[model samples]
Target: MDRIGLTTVVFRNRFASTKPKNQVLEDELTLLSTPEYFVDRFKVHNVEMWTPHFESTSKNYLKELKRSLKKERCKLINLQSEGKFDPSDPLEENRLKAVIEVKNWVDVAKSLQCEAVRVKSMKKSYSKAVLSLNEITKYAKAKGITILIENHSDLFSDYKNHTNIIKDVPLNNIGLLADFGNYSSNPVMFDSLKHIAPFTRLVSAKTKDFSNQMEHIPYDFQKCIGIFEASGYQGIYSCEQWGKANPNYDYEKITDWMIDNIKESI
Candidate 1:
């Protein structure tokens, strides 16, 4: 139960105003205040920050964020950095640019003293992803930060190809960020979860719909947790409720349900 934490994606509505072009909302969660909110509201010490939630990456801003986390005694476990650059782009110049963008985020993760930074496997070419991750992983390794490739979209949807990219990289600091609800079907989802469980450093316990009784209905949440546990995965289950942005739903209650689900399953 203590292993359960919160990802900022669960509070996307509250954070929408932080990004550019989004309407400023009355109730907003800034990067600096998120740590205290998580501790006060959820009693959790670990946080996985989304890239869009960050207002600035300046040194002073980062220092202030560090102070906020220290005051609340919370740890920044992972940074879900979704930069616009595509590492899997075929162009050499574009690939180099993408590698640089990810390296910058790696530096940010290092500055925040986070354990890992999650990057996307964009486009369809596995060879191109390998080319970019090779450089990104080497840079991340030197800073004592782990590089995580998530089953986000594009080529990563295929578990075999995703694992192959990791195998080709051959770096100790590079690993997987397994999400429970990212696959296509029930069988494939479970099989992919089991296949990648051994290489996963962090788990995104993604939830979408819940029954009136507060039971998760999209898939077998317990079975997903069991699969990872059976594979000897010892990592934080960062709770992420990724559903439609509904104003009626009580996010706090949903998060509590997810935390309880993961705890009971474990």
Candidate 2:
């Protein structure tokens, strides 16, 4: 059966303090909301955690986290790692660093029993990025976790680039994380989704505002879900509530409403 999940970044503001420029103070938000809180309160059985919201990936810490998830009966669907992942960086050292960092996240994914890890693409180096991702995919395969490439920014927002990366990656363990709200308009967004649907392993349904009819504004949830169904995608539609379209409304309230819309569409 298809299920719904959420990314930790959806509640980023509530997760951490944006006040401190320093990284240390920024992590204070993670302390407030945790895996336990998500499972117990939201009743989400599947979760996609953002790496920045976490402080450590030490063995003991991960062990405890795994224990907590098991206790709550929640599964870690994906681990969204935030770092400099443009393998096509002009500098060789930076490219090397990106690969190493992503590989480390793969290890963490293993510890968390996560099914996939989402990484961003480089706007500069398509070929180099593919090469680097191939290496990451090789490592992820051994750990039994998939490497997911998301259409997050710059060149990645283009559907052609997403398909190119998928075709050139040359790894079976690599796939795309199709995000609904990434594109600028409905036509382009739906077209891009169709292009990458064959490669999609997960979906990030980013919602900002809803209409009075309980439908997602700007982008139609019914049509979006139709595209997913047409593409034969049967996975969690991760509700990622972002953007400040309605600052007056609380995000949790918006999330609840989005969940209802998603249920109706599904």
Candidate 3:
């Protein structure tokens, strides 16, 4: 927590208990602002905010964000440029839409004083996402944008494929935002984290609710830290806490505990 720059996500589903959007947004800020007050809290800033619930290609979307970013505590934003899971989009149209959306995001990120915007390397349709990404990477220099891809489910099945895509794109500005637990659903989590960290410009320090589990879960803190260390990864390890929670688990407490355990236990 002390040396690391952190990030938080603002998923609409995470606020389901709150009745109104206004109320939910207010509650989210309260959680954020409290860290500003924590006595022993290290300097924390630069949060990653998601894109619109809709596609970012809308003409008015950039206009709306420009008007609103002034009100939020978002001096820096890790803007996710494309987000479509479930694999239902037509390959050609989706690729075109993503390009336009990323272009719009570049304009907005500059206007909003945002540092970096994340993007997908490509989709399962190798030829399309690859083709589009290559074009974007070529143009990215003039645009002053860097693309950071997560090991997002389905988009990247393994490190070999992921590394190949990074190679094909050939942009020094482009790199991985290695989500530490991306491969947690598989037996290869640690290895995947190790392999990708060298290419990492950002990292999502993923954690599960050990407190929520009925039995002791096996997450090696030392191994996770070792991967970053061995890779010479000196970048933001943005904590991502996912999966179920229990009645006894305090969300903030869980995060603070992980920061202490994982960082110090190393």
- N/CA/C clash count, model 2: 2
lDDT of 2 by residue, 187-232 (tens): 8988888888877888887876765555556777667767887878
- Rank by TM-score, highest first: 1, 2, 3
TM-score of 3: 0.74
Better of 2 and 3 by TM-score: 2
Span of ten consecutive residues with least summed lDDT in model 3: 30-39
Please write out the lDDT profile of model 1 over residues 1-266, one tens digit for every residue: 46887999888777864323554564688888899999998899998999888889999999999999999999999999877679999888888888888899999999999989998658756898998898899999999999998898568878997788778999999999898877788899999998999989999999887766777778988889999999998888999988654556777899988888888978
Model 2, position 88, has a per-residue lDDT of 64
How displaced is residue 43 in candidate 2, in Å?
A: 2.3
Clashes of 1: 0
- Prediction 1 global C-alpha lDDT: 0.86
| lDDT-sorted candidate list, best first | 1, 2, 3
Best by TM-score: 1
- The C-alpha stretches of model 3 lying farther than 4 A from their native spots are 10-26, 30-42, 52-77, 82-90, 120-123, 184-186, 212-218, 245-248
lDDT of 2 at 148: 89
